[model samples]
Each structure stands twice: as C-alpha cells, then as structure tokens.
Target: MMDRPVGVIGAGRVGTALGLALVRAGYELVGVNARSEASRQRAADVLPGTPLRDVPTLAKSAGILLLSVTDDAIGSVAAELADGGLLQPGQIVLHVSGACGLAVLAPATEAGAVPLAVHPAMTFPGLPTDADNLAGLAYAVTTRPHDRPLAEELVRDVGGVPVWIADEDRTLYHAALVLGANNLITLLAAAMEALMAAGVPDPGFVLAPLVRASMENALRHGDQALTGPVRRADVGTIEAHLRALRDRAPHLLPAYLDFGLNTARRSRRAALNEAGRLDEVIALLEARSAEARDDIDR
Candidate 1:
C-alpha cells in the first residue's frame, strides 16, 4: 500500500493536507474528488491540472482511498463508491474522522476493500503546519486485526504516532478529544474576549503564557492541576462572576458556569483567595452547581 498511489475523495483541509503531504512523502496522487465546484476549484488551485473524478472513480484509481469527508458523509460516500463496483479485492480505504470506527468503511469492506481509520489528535487550524503537525503527534487507529500492521505503517509513513482503540468505543474516544481541544478553544475565546473587555492591554500577552502554563500544569497533574478561584471555592468571586457574565456576555455565561461547575465538582473544595487554597474554591463550585441543579428540577 505504501508503494501504491492514493486517492482523496474530499479535498477539504484534511484531505488536501494529507494528499499534498503524501505526494511529498513519495506517494502518487492518482485520482481525486471534491464535492462542490468551489471545492473542486480549490483542489485544482492546489494541484493544478488534476481532473475532478467521482468518489467511485477515485476509489478505483488507488489501492488506498482516503475518505476525508465529514463524519456524517463518510458512510454514504463509501457506499456510493462501493455501489459503483470500483473496489478491487485487497484494496484499502481509510478515513480521518476521530469518532467514526471501521464501520464507516463497511461499504468498502463489502466490496472487498480493507477499512482503516486514522484519526490525528491535533487541531487543523490551517495548512502551515499540516505537513509537520502529525509528526510525533498521537493518532488513534481503529480497524480489523488483519489491517493493524498496514495502518500503523501508514501512520508512520505520514509522520504520526499510532495508538489503538476498540471498534465499539471509538465514539467515546472521539468525544474526549472534542472535550479537550474544542472546548479548550471555546473557553479561551471567552477568556480572551473578557480580558479585552476588562481593558487589559495586550490581552494575548497577558493570557497566552498564563494559559499555557496552566495547561502544562494540568496535563502534568490531572485534577490536582486545578487552581485559582474555582479550585479555592471563592463564593464571593463566583457570585460576582455570575452577575457580571449574565450582564455582559449572557450567551457565554451558561458555558462558563457549566464548565466551572463541573470543574468545581471534580475539585471538591471552598472559601479562600490564596494560592493552594483549592479546598475553598472546589467547595463553592460544587455548592453553586448543586444549587443550580436544585432550581432546575423545581
């Protein structure tokens, strides 16, 4: 499979990044497909003179077809290609969806194509780091036992660290990735905007290092990594936060509260402002969440 050319059915970010990188990694870009005229145009812009082919055509053209479409579209896209009678025996099909398991490639398998899922655990901000981001980054791989070696080889070929997961639990595994990466971004956006509103000059300068250090600490220590008001259970500060957020950014208030409450519940503490006063912070957060739950049920 490493020696064979590849096909990319969806020329979006992941598709394009992987396709271009594979080309650099010494794999031929045999055939490609992208849904919209806009997307096709975009692909053409990137790989000049590459003709647009249907999904099935893309499948037939390469031994390994990268099903880089969105999660919801993977199954149908695979099915359409399989129905076109394009899959040959011993061929391989793969997808980059974090949550989708081998089942997303069921159609390909039915058509005698081996299915593999290669989900990278890094965010796809843009193309600047696409080729290099997967290098040394953890990638979750789910597939049949027969396909494990091939999948691992492919992961390494593309400069990624491969890890295994069971077929049934892929969805939950994907959820955890979302909670960490996506939620972190959403939380940071809120904090950054808040800093700007509070008239903190050079908000990024003020927040990036602090946030990075906090993340570094948290990753190193797990729940014990918690700090600040929530960890200390500062009821007064929490109350003030509720009032101010409700007044200024109501939409973000719920998200902040929900995450805060969850963090508080996990930390389990209350009533102090000093460093390492997490006991006080945790208590207030837990208490605040409990009060919210009580009101909700009423």
Candidate 2:
C-alpha cells in the first residue's frame, strides 16, 4: 500500500494529522476529500500541493484511502464511495474510528477494496505537531488475518505500535478509551469549576500536581492506590460533601453521588474492613439520590 498513492476522505483533526504523518513517512499523498471547505483548507495545509477533490476523485486516484470522518458518517461515506464505482480490487481502505470496525466499510469491501480499521489511541487538534504526536503511541488495529501485516506496516510507518483488537470487543475497547481519556477531561473540568466555585483562584495550577501524581499512582498500583473519604468510608465527610454540593452546585450532585458511590464500592476490602461502616457511606449516597429524584419529581 505504501508503494501506491494515499488519500484522506475526512479532513478533520485526525484525518489531517494522519495524512501529514503518512506524508512524512514517505507515503505519496495524491488527494484529499472533506465535507467542508474549512476542512479542505486544513487538508491543504497539512499536505501541501495536494489536491482537495471529491471522495470519488480521491478514491480513483489513491490506492490507500483513510476515512477519518465521524463514526456515524463512516458507513455512509463508504457506501457513497463504493456506489461511485471508484474502488479497485487490492486497494486498502481504512477508517480511524475507535468505536467502529471494518463492518462499516462493507460497501467498499463489496467493491473489492480491502477494508481495515486503524484507531490511534490519542487525541488530535489539527496542528502540525498532531502528526508528531503519533510517535510512540499505540494504535488499535482490527483486520482480517490476511490483512494484519498490512495494518501493522501502516501503523509502524507512522511510528506507532499496533495492538490487535477483536471485532467483537471493539466497542468495549473504545468505551474504555473514552472513559479513560474523554471522561477524565470532563471530570477534571468539573473539578476545576468546583474549585473555582469554592474560591480557588487557579484551580488547574493547584490541582495539576495532585491529579498527575494520583493518575500515575493509580496506573502503577491499580485499586491499591485508592484514597480519600470514599476509600476511608468517611460517612460524615461524604455527607458534608453532599450537603455542600446540594446547596451550591446542585447540577454536579448526580455525578458526585454516582462516582463517589462507585469509588466507595471499589475501595479495597481491607480499607472497607478497617472502616467497618462502608455501608453507611453507600446508604448516605443512595438516600441523597432518592431525595434528589423526589425533589425533581415534585
């Protein structure tokens, strides 16, 4: 596939970054197709001198097509490209959607394109260094046994290590990634806002070291690194937290109760035994949740 020309079907952040990375890795970028003019300009910026054409034009010109559109659009895009009758046998077509598999590319496969799924386990911001960020990253590669070598080679060409993910587990694997990366961002933003609401002037600066250390420890020690009120089963402290959030940040109460209860549930057996009242914490959370629901119903 590297010997033949490459094209991008979505000029979003991931598409632009992957296109540039492949270009830097010596892949011949023939053309790119994006849904919008702004995305076409982004593609032009990433792959200078490359033409920005329609999907069919790109399909006709390139042997390896990278579909980096949103997950929902991938199937439709594949169907449209296949219906155009531009794909040829032996052509390698891949999508960079973590939540989807080669099934989304069935139309292209029916048109004789060899379908593959390659999802980089990293974020892209449509910048030049976004391509550089691909180095040393892990890519979830899903493909048929005969196409494994092709997938691995493409991953390596862009300085990534390929990890085989079974098609049946793709959605679960992607959900785990979302929980770890995307959900962490949401949690951290909530923490920052909560801190600001509590009068912390620079929440991020104050929280940075603690968050980093906690994450590193959690990664290194698993659940053994659990700490704080939930792990300690400090019912009084947790009750106080619920009260404060209810009075000042009611919008955050549901997430707090849910995550706190989950954390309490996952606390080490030894810690719960030591506290001897973990049930109290669970009860407090459950009662508060029911009360909140009752209030909403009222």
Candidate 3:
C-alpha cells in the first residue's frame, strides 16, 4: 500500500501539509480536490505539480484517498463518494479528524474500501513549513484490527508516531487534546490581554520564560507543580487580585475567579496541610463569581 497513489480532498492546512509530507516520503500524489480558492492556493503552494481534480476524479484515480474535510463533513463526503461508486474495492480511505473514528467512513467501508482514522496530534498554521512539524508528532489512529499495520505504516510515512486509539475512545482522546492545546492558547491570550491592560509592553517576552518553566514543571510534577496564591491559600492576595481585575479588566474577572477556584481545589487535593485554608480560598472565589454575575445582571 506504500506504493499506492494518494489523493487528498479538502486540501486545507492539515491536508496540504500531510500531502506534502507523503510526497516527500515517496508516495505518488495523483491529485487533490480543494473547494475554496484559499485551499486551492494552499494545495498549489504546498503540493506543487499535483493536479487539481474534482472529488469523483480524485477518488477514482488514487489508490489511497485522504478525506481531510472538517469533522462534520467527513461522513457526508464519504457517503457522496460511495453513492457515486467512486471508491474502489480494497482502496484505503482515511480521514484526519481526531474527533471521528472509522465509523464516519462507513459509507466507504460498505463500498469495500478500508477505513482508517489518522489524526496527527499537532496544530497546523497552514504555512508552507507546516509539514516540518509532523516529524516526531504523535498520531492518534483508530482502525479495524486487521488494518492496524497499514494505519501505522501510513502514519510513519508522514514522520508521525502511531498511537493506537480505540474507536470508542476517539471522542475522549480528541477532547483531551483540545482541552490541553486549545484551552492553553485561550488562557495565554487572556493573560496577555490582562498584562496589556496593566500597561505592560512586550507581554509575550515577559511571560515566555515563566510560561515555559511552568509548563515544564506541570508536565513533570503534575499537581505538585502548582504555586501562587491559590496553592498557598492566601485569601488576602486572592481578594486583592479580584479587586484589581474588577477595576482594570472587568472582562477577565469571571475567568480569574473560575480558574482560581479550580486551582484552590487542586491544591487542596494535593496538600492536606493546605486543605483548610484552600477551602476558604475556594469560598472567596465562589463569592466573587456570584458578585460578578450580579454586577452583570445589573
């Protein structure tokens, strides 16, 4: 199957990057199907010399079809190909949706195509260099037991390490990734916004080392790495923060309180010695949250 020609549908950031990686890995990219102008441009830029074809043509010409459409569009696209009799028997059909499993490609399976879910656990910024990030990344793959080897090989060809995920566990696996990666970005953005509001210049520069060290410590020590007023159970400091946020960054008050409450709970769980004071901190956060809600109502 490594020698089979590959075709990509919905040549967006991830699709184009993976296609480029496969092409570099010696797979013949027969064609691509990209609907929007931006996607078409991305495919042209990243997978230059690859022919742009329609869905039916791309599906028929390639021995392996990569359905890189949005999570919601995967099933519908697979059904369309199956309905049009575009998928051939023994052909490999895979999607790059972390949230979906082989079930989304049931239509292709019914058409005698092998279905696999191959999701790389990395973000793609749609740049030409996005393919470089694939190396050493973990790919969460879910497929039939018989197709496991094929899925692993495909992932390795794109420079990814295959991590077998159960079909039933795909949603939870993807949820964890979103919670870690996406929510981290949201948290950083909110923190930077608060810094700017406080008249700080070069917020990223100021936070870079601290954020890096905190992430490293958290990854290495888990909850034991937690610090700050929440961990210390400093109710006075927490109150001061709430007042400052309310005065200068009212929009951040709710998030600050919510995260503070969670941090206090985690600290309580981690340190029995701090549990008593942490309970007070939690109560303080909850009360502030309620007050913030009341202010919003007014």
CA-only RMSD, every prediction? 3.7, 1.7, 1.1
lDDT for 42 in candidate 2 is 82
Model 3 quality (TM-score): 0.97
**lDDT by residue for model 3 (124-159), tens:** 988889999998999999999999889989998878
Instruction: Give per-model TM-scores.
Output: 0.86, 0.94, 0.97
Best by lDDT: 3
Q: Which regions of candidate 3 deviate over 4 angstroms? A: none
Off by over 4 Å in 1: 45-49, 126-129, 247-250, 269-298
Clash number for every model? 12, 0, 0
lDDT of 1 by residue, 221-283 (tens): 888777766766677888899777767765566676788867766665322234345555555
- Superposed by TM-score, candidate 1 places the C-alpha of residue 293 at a distance from the truth, in angstroms, of 9.9
Ranking by TM-score: 3, 2, 1
Error of 3 at 101 (Å): 0.9
Worst 10-residue lDDT window, candidate 3: 269-278
User: Candidate 2 on 1-298: residue-level lDDT in tens?
Assistant: 5797898988878877888889899999988887688887787677778777787788888989999788999999899988988889989999999999889999999998899998889987677678879989999999989999889989999999999999989999999999898999989998888999999999999999999999999899878888898877778888899889988888888889888877877773546445447777778888888998898899
lDDT of each: 0.78, 0.86, 0.89
